[model samples]
Target: MATIASQVVLHPTVSQSLKYGSTTLGRDKAYRAIQYFARFYAWYLLSKGDKDAAARWNALKTHLGTARKLLRLGKPMEHLQAALRACLSTGPAVEQVTTIARQISYFGYLTFDAFVWANSIKFWTLNPETSTRVAKISNRFWFAGILFSIVNGVTKSVRLARETKKLQSTQKWGEKTLAAEAERETRLSVLLAAQENTRHQLIIDLLDAWIPATALGITNLNEGALGIFGLITSLIAAQKQWEAVNGKK
Candidate 1:
């Protein structure tokens, strides 16, 4: 039993999980997954007339949200740095423009969100009206950021598709061009991989957009639906982060 326990403690998966969870983003994503799950389960319980249980889950969700806010206290500056970097990076014009816009929007959102967190913790006080205004502004910026991301993804997908088609049409018969063909194949593979990544990010952004839309009163989706959407996106993001941390493809 001791040997078995030692083996479990020394497991590669366990070590990888520890590494992943060590990052602030990883911890926030884990908490977000739980928070959204709690939201959904609370709604489910309430629908089943389990008010007491629902309240417990609701409290858990709220606390997790507060914790995540605290965890992200310094993230606004990170977004600002990202925006600056985006502004300097060269890419397709549409992509570069949208990337800069998206990063700036996120910087705005997170900056306002820091205020919201402060208000929540009574670090500073804002009147009810002011608080509501700030929250709405943050949500609007978040919505705009997601919109820009979707546009960037769509534009990139189209460009990638065109490149892929052009590459496929370059093949010729009975030529001593093995090296050329091999290079073309490698380029095509990279394009396809990029296309897949763009599609995945598009789906995640699409799902996440609804959250801010509902907050902005543009959508009337219930907590249950929003919770499920958040949970899905969080899991997808977490999976990507896990792969990155583990150096896996």
Candidate 2:
């Protein structure tokens, strides 16, 4: 047991505790050491005038404060892990709200195409023979894609909100149990959002590629510029969406 213990690796701060002190020291000393390290890091960031980092540091202090309390009560590793897991599982509300806003804005852009396509009569003024039929068909396809996107967003938001509410209600649960519950809900939300995002991408592909190609076939110049713009914006939106789901910046 002594040989195995000698080979064990703790985090740098934890290892520092053992180096500076001894194993016989109370666990509270370990907790205090960790707390002091976090506070110093937070202070360094604040001194550099980083408000965002400072806020994050404050939140970390809150989480570590909880951990320190748990250690003082002599809670086991399992309880400590649970508290940390719950703290890390949360994604800010601002992120989700921003995503929803972008989705709505994309819907508005598609609506612009819908309006252009619906006015097939204007196309007839440019070319009397084929423009009218082509315009009507193009309008129908754009409208269908737009409507599908709207429904997808609304349903996904409602489902996520319901699940989030259910998760929030478990705040009073025991440490281990609440951690498991929060992790489960977080995973479920990600999966659900991912599935819907896939569907949304399909709709966007139709709008950006298919409808634009059709528009170029019918109206020529006016719709061509819009198509190019749509393609560019769709690519940007796709990158953002992918990053959001993958938990990247």
Candidate 3:
């Protein structure tokens, strides 16, 4: 029993989890999953006429959201730096432009969101109308960022498809002049991996876009649907973060 306890305490999974949760992004993703779950559960409770239970879950969701906003206080600068880096990186023109635009939009969103957080905490109060306007602006920027991301993903996917087709055709050449078979295979593998990543990101962006869209009054999805979408995207992001923390490919 002592050995089993020791083994459990020293487990690699436990260590990996600690490492993952140590990062702000990782913790935020975890909290986001719970927040959205609470949102959905609250909606469910309300539908069943359990106002008391629903209010509790709704309060949990709201509190987690406020905490997350606090956690993101320093993120605007990160996005600004990312936008600068994207400007310098070399890629297809469409990709380069969209990446930079997306980063800049996120920078704007986070900057405005910081003010919203401040208002929530009574650090400084905006008039009610002004606060609502600020929140809407933040949502608009977030929506734009996600839209840019979707555009980038679609463009990249198309380009990757073309490259993949060309590579496959070259492989069918009768002579061995087509690059070494091993090298060709390696390239194909890389392209396929990239395509997969792009598709995964596109799906995430599409689901997340609805969140800000609804907030901005561009969509009318209910809290339950929005909660489910947010939860799905958060889990997908968390899975990637977990794999990164654990050094898994």
Candidate 4:
């Protein structure tokens, strides 16, 4: 989760500092961060070191003692194996009497545990002959991949959640606009259909009439057309005026 938290906590500046640690300023920042992390980790570890923790730790050590005693006795290999086997069948009480047993027995379990811890910190890094301060420092920063992945996963989860919120909001707005447009198109189509019907009826009446009274004469043709246009205009104006008057009321 530190990776995600780092996003809002000045990661660029930190990365820059890490990259530029050869410089005095970067070195100072690294020192400060180290001090902070160390203090926090110490407090966390100390809190976990309770009475129950101590008891469990001691019990495990006693289990190791059971294995050590078998080896120290200089028994035959088969006898040693039998002792380790006996510890397992004896139950949890014998958990401290020997090492863990499953399909395989742990060889040199105590030394192996030490080696594993050291490997986690760049094991074999502090060789008596060739070790340097740089190796020691690097070891401290050699974090387990699992722990690193957890931090990254947490950060990514938070980002994805935020992105999802934005995507949902955008979708809602688009849907609302689409619905309103659909309604408007339905209303417009209805109005256009009604006007088209009225126009077709008017044309049919003029075509069917035998007299052709108003449009047949060339001299009256322009005047009739002008009158028709004036009538249409006046009808529109009257409707607008009625609407305005009604609005005032």
Give every collision pair in model 4.
1-151, 62-96, 63-96, 63-97, 118-123, 119-123
User: Tens-digit lDDT track for model 3 on 163-197?
Assistant: 99999888354767446887899999999989988
Number of clashes found in candidate 1: 0
lDDT of each: 0.93, 0.49, 0.94, 0.38
Q: Which pairs clash in the backbone of model 2?
A: none
* C-alpha positional error of residue 216 in candidate 3 after TM-score superposition, expressed in Å: 1.1
User: Can you write out model 2's per-residue Cα lDDT over 1-249, one digit (the tens) per residue?
Assistant: 876666565455556544434432233344444444455566667768897987786676556545544333322333345435534555645434434444443444334333333343243143544545544554554444455444545655566667656655655554577777777777777866665565555455544444434444653433334434354544545444434434454
Query: What lDDT is reached at residue 56 by model 1?
Result: 100
On lDDT, the leading prediction is 3
- Worst lDDT run of 10 residues, candidate 3, spans 170-179
- Tens digits of per-residue lDDT, candidate 1, 189-238, equal 99998998898899999999999999999999999999999999999989
TM-score ranking from best candidate downward: 1, 3, 2, 4
lDDT tens string, model 4, 122-185? 6355564334333332222221212232333344444445544444354334346777767656
Q: Number of backbone collisions per candidate, in order? A: 0, 0, 0, 6
Q: What is the RMSD, in Å, between candidate 3 and the native fold over all Cα? A: 1.8
All predictions: root-mean-square deviation over Cα? 1.6, 24.1, 1.8, 41.3
Candidate 3 lDDT score at position 154? 99
Best by TM-score: 1
189 Cα displacement, candidate 2 (Å):
5.4
Off by over 4 Å in 4: 1-57, 61-114, 117-151, 170-249
Q: Could you tell me which residue pairs clash in candidate 3?
A: none
Candidate 3 stretches with Cα past 4 Å from truth are 172-179
